[model samples]
Target: MKKIMRSLGLMLALLTLTVVVSACGSKPLSQRNVLKTDQQSKTITWGVKADTRLFGLLDTKDGQIKGFEIDLAKAITKQMLGKDAKAKFIQVTSSTRMPMLKNGNIDAIIATMTNTPERRKQVAFSNTYFYAGQSLLVKKGSSIKNVKDLNRQKGTVLGVVGSDSVENVAKVAPNAKVLQLTDYAQAMTALKSGQGQALTTDNGILYGMSVQNPDYVVTGGTFVSEPYGIAVDKAQTPFRQAVNQSLKELRANGQYQKILHKWFHNVKGFDYEEAARE
Candidate 1:
C-alpha cells in the first residue's frame, strides 16, 4: 500500500512538472524583450516572401530570395543593429507570417504585408514604408477589364489566402467568386490554367507578375489603398520604434530612394519618382 502511494505521488509530481514547463514554453512573446535579445545575438531573423516577384522572390540561379523587401531588410538591419549585425531570412507566406512572428520564429516581417485595422489588432506595425493599392491582373485580350467587369460576368477571382486582397475583392465585386490560393505563384498559375478570370492583389505584386508574364496585365487602377508596413510582435514598442526610426533615417539619407530605384526604375508604368516622393 505504501509503495502504491509512492508511485501515485511520483506520477502526480511528474505531471505537475510537465504542466509547468509547457506553460513556460507557451508564454507570450510580448512579455519578452525581443530587441535586447536581437542585440545580444547580433542577428535579426526576417520573415520574407519567397514567391512574390520584385518584392521577394526566390532566384532559381542563386537560391537566394531577392527584391525590394530583401534590400530594405538588409538596410534596416544594418541601421538598427550596426553594419556588422547579420540579417537572416526565412520564407513566410500570407498564412504563416503572423504565426511565425508571434511564436518567436522570426524577429520581424519585411514581406509585402499591408497594414489594416484588423491586422493591427493582432500584431504591431511600423509606419508606412511602402504604399500600394488593391488591383486586378488579367491575361491580355481578356474581356475582363476591371472589377466591375468581374461582377458583371460573375467571374471568379484568385486571391492569396490570409491576405486582405480576398476581403477587398469581396467588397468591390460582391457577385464574383473568390478562390484563395496558397501564394502568389500558385495564384498566377491558377490564372494561367483558367481556374480564375482575374487575380487580385496589391498592384505592386501584380506588376511583378505581369513583368514575368507579358501576357498578363494589371488593369482597373487601384480600388483600395494598401499601405505596407513592417510587422513585429505585439507590444514590442522598443523594437517597433527602432524599425520606424530606421525607416526615417533611410528616407532622409536617400538610401530608401536608391533601393526603390534599384528595383523599380525599370518597372514599366510604375512612377518611381512619385514613389520616391512618398
Candidate 2:
C-alpha cells in the first residue's frame, strides 16, 4: 500500500509540473480568443524607454510614466482592445527591445527605435509613425555643424555600439573618429566629458536632450532619415496587422494627432508636418 501511494503521489506531481510548464510556454489558452479580442484577458504589454526624458520618463509625483510614446501607446491600446485592456509598461533599452518582443515579453515596442532594414529582418513594422533624421548633438556654441564638417581634426563621434546610427555615422563621416558606447546615456556622457566632439543619433532624441540642457544643442541637418514604427515579432503577423489597424484607427479618429500635439507641440524645434511624412 505504501509503494502504491508513493507511486500515485509521484504521478500527480509530474502532472502538475507538466501543466505549469505548458502554461509558461504558451499564451493563455482559450478557444474564444481565436477571433475575438480576449476581453477577459485585458492585458497589453508595451516596451517603452525609461531614461529618455521628453519621449518617455517616470513622473515622480504620480509614479507613472508620461511621454509622447507612452500616450500614443495607450491610445492605440484603448482603440484596439477596449478600455478594459490594462496596459502594462516594460522598460526596454536599444538592445533589449528586440529580444523582449521575440520572447513575448512585450506585445509591441513604441520606444524611440528606428525601423532599419536589419531590424525589419527580425520584426515587422507598422506604418511610418514619426520620421526622424540623423543629426549631431554638440555643446552649445560649438563649431561643429554638420556631418560634412567632420574630419580627423575635430574629435570622436560618439554613438551606441548596436544602434543603426553608428553605421550611418561611419558612412557619413569615414575620417571622423568613432567611439561606441553601450547605450545612449553613455554616449551622451562621453560627449559631455569632451571624449567626443559630438554625438550622432536621431534628431528626435537630440531634440529631447537639447530641451533638458540649454548648454547642449543639436547641430547639423539630418544625415540619414529614420522612420519610427511599432515593432512586433516577425512571426506574429496577425498581431502585427492588428497593431497597424489600431494605428490607422487612431489616425482616423484624430487620437494620434491629439497625442502628438500633447507632448510634441510643446517641444522646441518640432515640425509636425515633417514628422508625419515618410
Candidate 3:
C-alpha cells in the first residue's frame, strides 16, 4: 500500500508540472508564428530606440517616438498589415531589444541593430536596411581626427555596454584603452568629463550626438562597416519574409528615399545619395 501511494503521488506531481509547462508555452509570432494573427488584431508592435536621433527618438512636444527607423517600422507594418493597421512602439536599447524580441514583447525590432554572426544565432534578420560605420566623437577642437589618432598609451575610448563598438575600438585602436558604460548618454558624459578622450560608436549615432551638442563633432569617417537590419525571432519565417518584402517595396516606391531625406537631409556630411542604395 505504501509503494502504491508513493507512485500515485509522483504521478500527480508530474501531471501538475506538465500542466504548468503547457500553460507557459511559447508566445505568438514566435514559435507559434502567424502574420495573420497580427492582421486580425489590427496592431503590430515594434521595438525601437527613443534615444538615437535620425534612427529613433522621442519627440518631447508630441510625446511620440519618431525617427527614420520608426517611420520605416510604420511603413513596414502598413505594408504587411494593411493601411489601417495600428503600430505600437516600445522603447528598446542595444542591450534590451534582443531579449525583448525572444520573449515576444515586440513583434519586430526595427531598432538600429547590426547583424552579426553571434546575433544571428539568436534571431532572424531581414535584409540589410541601412549601412552605418563605426566612428568617433570628440570635442570640436580636439586633436582626435580619426581612429588611427586614438592609438596611443593615454588614449581612452568610451562605448556603451553590450555595444559592438567597445570591441571594435580595440580592433581599430588596439593601443587605446576602452571603457564600457551603461548607454550612449553615460558614455557621452564620460567623454565630456574627460573620462575618455573620445566616444566611439556608429557614425549615424555619432552624428545624432553631434546634432544635440554643437561642442562635439564626429571625426574619422567610419573605420568599420555596421549594416543595420530588422530583427525577428528565428521561428517567425512568415514575418521575416514579410519584412524583407516590405523593404524591397519601399525602395521600389521611392518611399525609402523620402524617409531618408526627411531625417538626414539636414545632417551635415551625411551621404544620403550613397545610402539610397538598397
Tell me the number of clashing residue pairs for each predicted model: 0, 0, 0
TM-scores of the candidates are 0.90, 0.88, 0.89
Q: Put down candidate 2 lDDT per residue, 206-251, tens digits, no spaces.
A: 8887887779988888889999998876665666677788888888
Off by over 4 Å in 1: 1-27, 273-278
Model 2 off-target regions past 4 Å?
1-24, 27-40, 152-154
TM-score of 1: 0.90
Pick the TM-score winner: 1
Residue 274 in model 1: lDDT: 44
Clashing pairs in 2: none
TM-score of 3: 0.89
Report the CA-based lDDT of candidate 1 relative to the real structure: 0.91
lDDT of each: 0.91, 0.80, 0.86
Between candidates 1 and 2, the lDDT winner = 1
* Model 1 / residue 258 / CA error / Å: 0.6
Over 63-166, each residue of candidate 1 has an lDDT whose tens digit, in order, gives: 99999999999999999999999889999999999999988899889888999999999999999888888899999999999999999999999999889999
Error of 1 at 213 (Å): 0.3
Candidate 3 colliding pairs, count: 0
Q: Select the stronger candidate by TM-score from 1 and 2.
A: 1
